[model samples]
Target chain A: MKIAFTTKGREWQSEMEPRFGRTDYILIYDEDKDTLIIFDNCEAKSHEHGAGPTVAKILIENGVNVLITGNGPGGNAIEVLKKSSIEVYSGAIEMSVKEAYDKYKNKKLPRF
Target chain B: MKIAIASGKGGTGKTTLSVNLASLLAQKNSVFLVDLDVEEPNAKLFLAGELLSEEPKYKMIPKWSEESCTFCQKCVEVCNYHALLGIANEILVFPNLCHSCYACSELCPTQSLPMFAQKMGTARHYVMPDMELIEGELDLGEEQAVSLISQTKTYVDKLLLKDTIAIYDCPPGTSCPVIEAVKDVDFVILVTEPTPFGLNDLKLAVETMRVLKKPFGVVVNRYDAQDDRVFAYCESENIEILAKIPNDKALAVLYSKGALIYHSSKSVKCELEKISCFLKSLTCKERA
Candidate 1:
C-alpha cells in the first residue's frame, strides 16, 4: 500500500506541511517498491476554494491508501477521502516527512 | 432605481440606512427594502409590517444517478466545484461545495448527473404602511451567499415595477455576496464609519464599486465630528459623501431595542433626508 504526506519540499528531510489542502507537494511513499513519488500541488495551494477535494482527487489518482499529514483534510475533501476508503492520519505538523513516515510505521500517529 | 447599500465593514449601519431611506422614500414614492444579507438579514426586525408571503428558495444541484450504468467519471472530471466524486460503483455528491453551475450535470456522458432543486434559503415578504420588505435568509451552514443574493434579486425583480425604487441592504465585506448585491443595481451607496477599520474596508468597497463600474457614493455612519479620515479619503477618491448620521447614543439605544431611529430621532431623520435627496437625482430605467 502507498502512503502520502503533505510536505514543503521533494526530499525525505522536507518539513511536513501543516496544511493538507494547500501543501506545496504531496510526497507519496510506495512501501512495496521502497520508492518515493513527488506530486507538485502548487495549483491546489493557490486554488480559491475546494483545495481539499482537489488534493483528495490527487491522492485517489495516485492510489494513496493512507494520507499522513498535518491537520487532516477539511469537510469537502475529507468526505471524498472517506468515501474513497483512504485512511487519513494527522498530527505530523511538527516533524519532517521521514519522521512522520517513521511515526506512522511505529503506530505513533493517530487517525484523523 | 435599485440602490444597494453596502459596507465592507460590518455594523456600519447598512440596515439602519436601508430601512430609514426606504421609509422616507415610501412617503412620496413606492419603495421596496430588500435585505440581501441572507446570512444575518435583520432589516425586517426594525419594520412594523404584516407578513405577506414567505417562500422557500432553491438552487439547482447535480444529483448522481447510479442506474445509468457507465462509471466513466465524466461528471467528476467536469465539476469545477469538486462537488462530485466518482469511484468504482458510486459517485459521491457534496452539495455544500456545489456552486450549481450545471457543468457536471450537462457534461455527464450517460446523463447520470441530473440537476435537482435543493432548498437553500427563504424569501419573506412583509407589507408595511407605505413600503414593503423582502429579505432572504440562508439556512445555517449554507456555503454560498452570492447564489442566495442573486435568487433574492430575481424574486425581487419579479415583484418590482416601473418608477418604483428598490433598496438592497447588502451583506458586509467586498466579497461575492456584496458583488452580487451591487452588480446590477442602478446605484450603490457604500456605508462606512470614521474609524480605521471602517476606512480600510471603505477603500475596498470603493475599489469593488469602481471595478463593477457602478455609480456609487459614500454614507458615513456613526460619524464623529472629530475624525475626518473618511472625509479625506472620499475627497481624494472623488466620491460624494452622501450623508453622515452622527455618532449618537440615542440611536444606539434605539437600535439595540430594535426600534427605527429615524422614526423617533430628529438627527437621524435629517441625515436620511440628505441621502434621499441624492438618491432622487438618479433615475431608474423604465421597465420594458
Candidate 2:
C-alpha cells in the first residue's frame, strides 16, 4: 500500500505540514517495500483557487491509497478521495513523515 | 461611447460617481447606466425610476444520460473545474462547481453528455424620462458572476441607440468580475479616495486599466488636499485628474439616505458636470 504525508520539507525528518492542498512537499511511503518517494508540490502553490482537488488528483495519479496529514482535506478533495476509496488520516502536526506513518500503522491517527 | 466607473477598493463611491455622472450626461444625450456589481448592487438604491422589466439570465451546464454513457471518463478528463467524477461504473456531477464551459459535452465521445441552461441571475431594466438603468443581480451563493455580467452587457448592447453614452458601474478589486465589467469599454473612470489604502488600490486599478489598454482618468473622491499622495502619484504618472470631490459630512448623510447629492448640493453638481463635460469632449473627439 502507498501512504502519503503532507510535509513542509522533502525529507522524511521534515515536519508534517498542516495544509493538505498547499503543502510544500508530499512524502509517499511504500509500506510493502519500505521505500519513500518525495514529491515537490510547487505547482499547487500558485493556484488561486481549486488547489485541493488538483493536489488530490496528483496524489491519486501517484497511486496513493492513504493520506496522512495534519489538517483535513477540503470538501472537494474529500469527495474525490472518498470516491477513489482512499483513506485519509489526520493528526500529524509537528511530527515527521516516519512518525506519522507509524501512528497510522498503530491506528493512533484520527480518520477524517 | 461606453464609460466604466471602477475602483480597486470597496466603498470608494463607484456607484455614487456613476449615478451622478449618468444623470448629468442624460440631460442632453441618451445614457444607459449599467450596474455590473452583481454581488452587491447598490446603484438601484439611489436611482429612482419605474421598473420596466426583469429577465433571468441562464448559463449552460452539462447533463449526462446514464443509459448512453460508456463510462469512458472523457468528460471527467476534460472538466477543469473537477465538476465531474467517474466512480465505479458511474459518473457524478457537481453543478455548483461547473463553470459552464461546455467542454465536457464537447469532449464526450459517446455524446451522452447533453448541455442545459441553469438560472444564475436576473437582469433588470428601469427607466426614467431621460436615462435608462440596466443592472445585473446574481442569485445568492451563485459563483458565475462573469457570465451574468457578460449577459447584462449583451442585453444592453441590443437596446443601445446610436451615439448613446453607456456608463458601467463596475465592482471593486482588479479581479475577473472587474475585468468583465470594464473590458472593451470606450473609457474607464477610476474612482479612488485619498489615503494609503486608496493609493495602493489605485495603483492596482491603474495597472489593470493599462493592461486592458483603455483610456482612463482618475477621480479623487473625498479628496483632501492635506493628503497629497493621490495627487502626487497621478501627477508623476502624467494621468489626468478629471475631478476632485471634497470630503463632506453632508455628503455622507445624503448617501446614507440613498439620495443623489447632485440633486441638493451645488458644489457636487458642478464637479459631476465637469466630469460629464470631460466625457462629452471625449465623445466629440471620437465623432470628429
Candidate 3:
C-alpha cells in the first residue's frame, strides 16, 4: 500500500531524520513528478503550513492509503485526509513516522 | 464588573499583569481571577492555590448508525464543515472536523444520526490566597477549545455573580476562544509590549474588540523596549494608554518562578492601583 507521513515542515527536512523504522518512503512535491511524489517529505521546507498539507493532498490523490503523524488527528490537515478515507494514527510524537506506520499496520496503534 | 487582560501574541506578560492586578484588588474586594488561557494556563502558579476540582465535557458530534443509513447524501450535502461523507459501504463521520452543529443529524435521511458527546477536557477551579482562579484545560487530542471556554464562562457567571472585581487572563491569540472570553466582560485591558510583533498583533486584537463593540484600553508592557509603533497606533485609533510597565528584569525573574510582581515590587502596587481606579471610572461611565 502507498503511504505518506504527515509531519511539521521543520521535522521533514532536518538532517536528523529521527529514526523512522516502519515506512521507508516519504512524500514530497517533486519538480520531476510535477505533482506530490512519494520520495521523502524531508525534501520539503521547514516550519511551513502549506508545504506539508500540499504534499499530503498530493499523496492522497495519488492513492496513498495510510498517513502517519506526531500529534492527535485534529486540525485542517486531518480534515483533508478524512475526506479521502485514509486511516490516520493520531498518537506518535516520540516514535519516527515510519515506526508509527508499522505500529498501525501491526494493529498496535488504536484507531481514533 | 470584570476586566480581562489579553494579548494578541503569546509570551507578552498577560498572565503577569492579570495575577498582580488581581492580587492588588483582592485586598479590598472579593477578586476572582480566571485563567482562560486553556492552552497553557499558568495563572494559578502566581497565586498560592491548588486545583479544587475538574470535570470532563465533550464537543457533541452527530453519530450515524449504519443500520438506518440508506446511503442518502442529505447529511453530506447539508454539512458545511465537510465532516460527513457517504462512502460506498457506509456513511463516515469525522469527529475532529465536526463543528458540533447538529445539522447532519437533523437532515439525516432515516434519522439514524444522533448527537452524542465526546470527551473534550476538564475545567479546574482553584482557590488562592486572595482570589479564585478558574482554568479550562482541553484534552490533548481534542479539537474544540471554544466549547470548554464557554463552559468556564457559564460557571464563572453563575458562581461569581457577586464578584464585582473579577480579572480574566485570556488566551494569547485573537481567535474564537479569545473572542468567547471577552464577549461579556465589562472592560478589556489589551496588554502588549512595544515591539514590531507586539504592535502588529495589537492591531489585530484591537480590530476584533472594536468589531465586538467592547470598550477597551491598551497596556504597554516592557515600555522601555524603545519601540513607538504601538504608541503611534494607539494614538491614531484613540485607544487610551492605561499603563506602561517598564522593562524590569526583576519582574521577569519573579514571573519565571511563578510569583506575582506586586509581592516583590512597590511600583507595580502603585501601577495596579491606578489601573483599578481607571477601571472604576470606566465602569461608572457604563453604569451612568
Candidate 4:
C-alpha cells in the first residue's frame, strides 16, 4: 500500500503542510518497498484559481491509497479524490510527517 | 462610444455614477447602461423599466465521452486551467476550473472531449422611458465572472446604435472580471474615495488601465474636501479628475431610496454634467 503526506521538506520529520493544494512537497511512503520518495509540488504557488484538481491528479497518478493532509483540497480537488480509491484522512496540520504517519498507523487521525 | 465606470474598492458609488449619468444623457441622446457587475448587478435596482427580454447565458464546458476514449491523456495535457484529469480507465473534468478555452476539446484526437453549453447566468434587457438598461446576473456559486461579462457585452453590442452612448457599471477590483468589463471601452471612469484603502486600490486600478493602454480618469465619490491624498495622487500621475460628487446626507438618503440623484440633488447633478462634458469631448475627438 502507498500513502502520501503533504510535507514541507524531503525528510521524514519534515512538517506537514497546513494546506493541501499549495503544499511545497509531496512525500509518498511505500509499505511494500519500505521506502520514502518525495516529489516537488512548488507549482501550487503559481496556481491562481484551482490548484486542487492537478495536485490531486498527482496523488492519483502516483498510486496513493491513502492521503494525510491539512485544511483542504478545496471542492475541485475533492471531486478528483472522490472518484479515486484514495482514502482521505485530514487534521494533520502543524504535525511532522512522521508524526502524522504514526497517527495514521495508530488510527488516531480523523478520516474524511 | 463606450465608457465604463469602475472602482477598485466596493461601495464607492460606481452604480450611482453610472445610473445618474445614463439617466441624464439618455434624455437628449440614446444611451445603453449595462451593468457588467454580474456577481451583484445593482444598476437595475435604481432604474425602472419593463423587462423586454431575459435569456440564460452559457459557458462552453467540456464533456468527456468514454466511448471514444483511448486514454491518450491528450485532454489533460492541453487544458491550461488543469480542469481535466486522466486516470486508469476514466477521465474527469472539473467544471469549476474550466475556463472554456476549447483548447482541450479542439486538440483531442478522437473527439473524446466535446464542448457542451452549461448555464452560468441570465441576461436581462430593460427598456426605460428614454434609455435601455442591460444587466447580467451570475448564478450563485459561479466561480468566474469574465465569461458572463463578455457574453453580456456581446449582447449589448448587437443592440447598440452608431451614435448611442454605452455606459458600463463594472464590477469592483482590478481582477480579470474588471479587465474584461473595461476591455473594449473607449474610456474608463474610476470612482474612488479619499481614504487610504480607496487610494491603495485606486492605484492598482490605475495600473491596470495603464497596462491596457486605455484613456482613463478618476471621479472622487463621497468627496471629503479635507482629504487630499486622492487629488494629490491624480495630479502627480497627471491623471484628470473628471468629477467630484460631494458628501451629503441628502444625496445618501435619496440614493438609499433608489432615487436618481441627478434630479433630486443639485450638487450631484452638477457633477453628472461635468462627466457629460467629458463624454462629449471624447466624441468630438473621435469626429475630429
Candidate 5:
C-alpha cells in the first residue's frame, strides 16, 4: 500500500504541511517495501484555483491509496478521492513526514 | 460610440457615473446602458424603469457519452481546466472547473463527447422613456463572469440602434471579466479615488488598458482639492484628468437612496454634461 503525506519539504525530516492541495511537497511511503518517494507538487503550488482536485489527481496517478495530512481536503477533492476508494486521514500536524507515517502505522491518526 | 466606465477598486462610483451619464445622454440621443458587473449588478437599483424582458444566459459545457467512449482519456487530456477525468470505467465531470472552451468535445477521438448549454446567468432588459438598460446578473455559485459579460455584450449588439451610444458599467478590478467588459470600446473612463489603495489598483488598470491599446482617460471620483498625489501621478504619466467630482455629503445621501445626484443637484448635472461633451469630442476627433 502506498501512503502519501503532505509535507513542507521533500525530505522525511520536513514537517507535515497543513494544506493538502497547496502543500509544497508530498512524501509517498511504500508500506510494503518501506521505501519513500518525494514529489515536488509544483502545479499545486502555482494553481490559483481548483488546486485540491488537481493535486488529488496527481496523488491518484502516483498510486497513493491513503492520504495523511494536517488539514482536510476541499469538498470536490474529497468527493474525487472517495470515488477512487482512497482513504484520507487528518492528524500528525507540526510533525515530520516520518513521524506522521509512524503515527499512521500506530493507527493514531483520525480518518476522514 | 461605445464607452466603458471601469474602476480598479470597488465603491469608486463607476455605476454612479455610468447611470447618470447614460440618463443625461439619452436626453439627446439614443443610449444603451449595459451593467456588466454581473457578480453584483447594482445599476438597476438607481434607475427608475419597468422590466421589459429577462432571458437566461447559457454556456456550452461538455457532456460525455459513455457508450461510445473508449476510456482513452483524450478528452481528459485536452481539458486544461481539469473538468474531465477518466477513472476506471467511468468519466467524471466537474462542472465548476469547466471553462466551456469546447476543446474536450473537439478533441474526442470517437466523437463521444457532446456539448450542452448550462444556465450561467440572466440577461435583463429594462426600459425607460429615453434609454434602454441591459444588465447581466450571474447566478449564485457561477464562476463564468467573463463568458456572461461577453454574452450580454453580444445580446446588446444585435439590438443597438444605428446611432445609439452604448455605455458599459464594468466590474471593479483588472481581471478577465473587466477586460471582457472594456475590450473593443471606443473609450474607457477609469474611475479612481484619491487614496493609496485606489492609486495602486488604478496603476494596474492603466497597465491593462495600455496593453489592450484602448483609448482611456481617468476620472477622479470623490476628489479632494487637498490631495495632490493622484494629480501628480496623472501629470507625470501625461494621462488626462477628464473629470473630477468633489467629495460631497449631499451626493453621498442621494447615492444611498439609489437616486442620481445629477437629477437633484444642478452643479453635478453640469459636471456630468461636461464629461459627456468631452466624450462626444473624442468621437468627433476619431471621425475627423
Candidate 6:
C-alpha cells in the first residue's frame, strides 16, 4: 500500500510517521489487493481563512483515495470534491491515523 | 476600506490592538469590528454587545444508492478521496468524508448517487451601540474554518447599511484561515512582539502577506522594554512601522481583569490613535 499523510502542525511531525497521529490527511492505495485503503483528511492547512478550496483542489489533483482528517468542508467545496472523487472525514481530527484507517478497514466508521 | 489585524503566533496581543484601533476609528467613521478568529473569538469580550442574530450554514455530501449499484467499483476507483465504499452487495456513503464533487454520481453508470446537505456552522452578528461585531463559529469538532470565515464576510457585506470602515481581527498562523481573512482587504497590520518566537512568526506572516500581494506594515507590541531586533528587521526589509504599545504592568493588570488595556491607560489609547492616523494616511496614499 502506498500511503501519504499531511502533517497537522509542525510540532507533530516527529510523531506522525511513527503512529499516524500528526498529519492532517492520510491517502493510502492498496494496489495488489484491489481494494482502496482510506484514512482521513486532517491537514491543518485548510483551516486558514481562504484555503478550503485550494486545499480540496490539491487533494483531488493528487489522486488521494482517502482523506482522514478533521474538518467540516465548505458548501461549494463539497461539490468540487464530489466531482473530484475526494472524500473528507470531518470528525477525524482527534482520531489517530491508525485508528481511522483501522475503522475504514473494518467498515466501522459511518458515512457523513 | 477593510483592514485586517493579524499575528503569526498566538498570545501576541492581536485582539488588544484590534479593539483599541477599532474604537478609535469609530469616533470619526462608522467601524465594523469583525472577529475572524472563529475558533476563539474574543473581540466581543472587550466590546459591550448583545447577540443580534445567528444563521446556520452547511456543506453538501453525496448520497449513493446501493439498490442499483452493480459493484463495478468505478466509483471507488475514480474517488481519490475514498469517500465511497463499494461491496459485493452494498455501497456505503460517508458524508463527512465526501468533498461533494459529484464525480461518483457523474461516473456511476446507473446514476445511483445524489447529493445531500449538512450543517457546517453558525455565523453570529451582534450590534453594539457604536459598532457591529461579527463572528464565525465553526461547529465544535468541525475542520473547515476557512469556509465559515468566507461565508461570514458575505453576511457582513449585507449588513453594511452606509459607508463605513472595518477592522477585522484575523486568526493566528499564516494558513488558509489567515489568507481568507486578509484577502481582498485594503491593508493589513501584522502585530508582533520583541522575542525570537515573535520574530520568527512575524516572518512567516509577512511572507504569507507578500504571497497574497497585500500591502502590510508592522506593529511592535510591548516596545517599552524589549530588544531592538524587531525594529532592525523592519528597517532592513523596508516594512513600515505603524506604532508600538509599551509594556506596562499596569496595563497588563487591567487586561488580566477582563478590562481593555487601552481604556485604563491614556498612553495606550494615544499610541493606537497614532497608528489609526498612520493607517489612514497610508490607505489614502495607496488609493491615490
Residue B14 local lDDT, model 5? 98
Model 3, span B116-160: residue lDDT tens: 988887788888777788888888877667888888878788777
Give TM-score, chain B, model 3: 0.95
lDDT of each: 0.88, 0.88, 0.73, 0.91, 0.88, 0.72
Q: Global lDDT for candidate 1?
A: 0.88
Candidate 2 residues A1-112, lDDT tens each?
9999999988778899999888999888888998889888888666665567767877877898999998889887787677677889988998887788778889999989
Order the candidates by DockQ, highest first: 4, 1, 5, 2, 3, 6
Clashes of 6: 45
Tens digit of lDDT per residue, candidate 5, span B1-288? 899999889889999999999999989999999999999999889888999999999988888898998999988778777787676677878887888899989888888889899999999999988889999999999987999999999999999876789999999999889999998799999999999878888899899999999889999889887778888898999999888888899999999999988988887787788888898898789889
What's the TM for chain B in candidate 2?
0.95
Runs off by more than 4 Å, candidate 5: A47-49, A90-112
Please tell me how candidate 5 rates in CAPRI terms.
Answer: acceptable
State which candidate, 3 or 5, has the greater TM-score. Answer: 5
Q: Write the per-residue lDDT of candidate 1 for residues B90-183, one digit (tens) a residue.
A: 8888898889999888888788888999999998999998898999999998977888899889989998998789999999999888888988
Candidate 3 global CA lDDT score: 0.73
Restricted to chain B, the TM-score per model reads 0.94, 0.95, 0.95, 0.97, 0.96, 0.88
TM-score for chain A, candidates 1 onward in order: 0.97, 0.94, 0.53, 0.95, 0.94, 0.55
**Taking the tens digit of each residue's C-alpha lDDT, what string does model 6 give over B44-90?**
88888889998997776777776887788788667755566553245
Best by lDDT: 4
Cα interface RMSD of each candidate: 1.8, 3.0, 7.0, 1.5, 1.9, 10.5
TM-score against native, each model: 0.91, 0.86, 0.75, 0.93, 0.91, 0.69
Model 4 reproduces a share of the real contacts of 0.64
Q: Which of candidates 2 and 4 reaches a greater lDDT? A: 4
Best by DockQ: 4
B63-144 in candidate 2: lDDT tens per residue?
8799999899999888877687775577767677788888899989888889998899999999977799999999998887
